[model samples]
Target: MAKIHSHFDHVGSYLRPQALKEAREAFAQGKISKEELLDIQDRLVKELVHHQVENGLEVISDGEFGRSWWHLDFLWELTGFEAYQQEASYKFHGAKTRTTNVRLNGQVAENPNHPFYRDFEYLLSITPAGVTPKVTIPSPSLVIKRDHRSDLYADYYESWTDFLDGLAKAYHDTIQRFYDLGARYVQLDDTTWAYLIQQLETYQDQPEQRRIYEEIAEDDVYVINKALEGLPEDLTVATHICRGNFKSTYLFEGSYQTVAKYLGQLNYDIFFLEYDDERSGDFAPIVDIWNGRDQVELVLGVITSKDPALEDIDAVIDRIQEAAKLIPLKNIGISTQCGFASTEEGNILTEEDEWKKLRLIKTITDQVWG
Candidate 1:
């Protein structure tokens, strides 16, 4: 099994074109059939993939055009989970998100007919010959942590340990299925680790909150490792740690020092870390964990996805060199801090701006890695 490396890659979700959104709404209103809606999505996805190729990206996603939310959509597709409308929305910095949530509706199990596999298949069929089709799913810990309403799962499992056991087996089986379907690279999009970092600042003086944070961190490590157990060595597993992005607003702000120890224990081969601004702190914590581990590479997200501003190429190159001093230059890569749009609304940037940002990423990557 050969290791996979790339100078530049994206964090998955792209802004949804207005036409596709209209088509989805029409389908929901019963004006169009499921086939009609899929046709619209297929056309839009092809255009998005073409743009990715045109921009010089080595890896491509379907732009997540077929779904509403990044993580919730994937979770709803699995067995034993149900999506419902909540009374209140998730509050972000100066913004609010959709009032949607998911819960365990029954005993958890891996659905052999998960829709994401089919989505990946479509992406693979249309991708260019040399380009690798990457699939991104919410990390097992993210799902388990978010859907933690006691009332929702108490009836389904005898204890938290029992629930975790089922969740881990389901994820392990799903990853194997992904490999069997020709997926060589899969990324686990996780924000729980970032949330934990934020909690450290919000509850530093509170002993109870500190204890809760430590417990969740431990569970996160256990669940993620269990989910990745026995995965094929050739399969490239990457984890993207984000601080929540919705319409250019963030849900949390803090440094990575709080969760540095847990991050070092993750089994992922690549780390798509958010480092576009001061909120993410410095690279010293990462340096401590990386410690010359040649197998682990860092995809520095020095470019901001939340804004349309183009980064200075020379400055970006200098930052990459600075990171190289901590980790080997050969193991460094470049990407956006987060996706252009983590949800359907996307950030407050024009489509043209998004393209410019990607082009900037390629330009910086070439100058540094070449």
Candidate 2:
């Protein structure tokens, strides 16, 4: 629907490593206060904003540097939620459940000074006079999934319907606020749908959980579309769905087939689907779903972020052609499977390697879309 524009997911690396390392080491040794650390975080934020714009990137994020974790800290920072730490067993690929204490929500508060609000304000203030920068927030669907604690919520919220209703309302309000502050592109980073796909084979074993996940997928679409409902039509919205890209370990593995219903019916203007490897299965399902929809756009993730080796240009082009066979070539574009750093702990690649990967993406985009 638009010209061949290029954007990336999770581009900002870390909180300016040099400043962070110095500040962290000093703070750990009792040389700096929390305020001082946050001050350094602010400086790093500016540097990151500049770096993202300078890297030939049109869409920019805070690189998620200010917070400790990507999803929870920001969700915790928002008003209307009291977050506390709890350890749980979450599986990733072949590994056993690792004990990680992530933030869980209890209540919602109202405030004019939310961290995400301030994060967007600060970025807007520092952005060069004319450049429009995009702000990313974890998908409300994923946030609800992350905050799902059966023990705490089953008693208070009483039923799944009430809980999801509130969850959807919170997100709708949050996006409204962001839109008021000049956010043109709001990318919802989510993996819940992928998680559902990954556990498909075992669905029969947990019939109730399967039902819950199915509802979650539909709720995910409903919440996003609800949030987008009265907003300016030009405020381009897109979604980046992934199979948990943490430490290169995955939580889901399958093709676009598992989630084709939602993918085909999603109300967003654009969909960024993962097709970097066999772990993502085939593109045939998406091609079938996308049939006859000229308005929806697809970003084909042809470059793999899992390894350091660069992809052969010809092979990359061939993959694009394969995907184009399913979805119209005009509706498809290209990008990496995931970001260089989906979390605070960056991926295994060196910073230089990350740029190389991006350069290749740019090169291929120029050749294919031009």
- On lDDT, the leading prediction is 1
Best by TM-score: 1
Candidate 1 Cα misplacement greater than 4 A, ranges: 147-151, 289-291
lDDT of 2 at 26: 83
* Predicted candidate 2, C-alpha RMSD: 3.2
* Residues 1-370 of candidate 1: C-alpha lDDT, one tens digit per residue: 7767897989888999999989999999999999999989999999999999999998889988988887989887778888888788886889988888887888777889998888888888899999988989988776655645324666888988888888888888888898999899999998898888877778889989788888888888888899899999999999999899999999877878888889888888889989999989888877755655788888889999999989989888988888887788888888999998899999999889999999999888788777
List the pairs of residues colliding in candidate 1: none
Give me the displacement of residue 309 in model 1, in angstroms. 1.2
Global CA lDDT computed for model 1:
0.86
lDDT of 1 at 44: 92
Model 2 regions lying over 4 Å from their true place: 1-18, 21-30, 94-111, 145-147, 154-159, 204-209, 288-291
RMSD for all candidates, in order, please. Answer: 1.4, 3.2
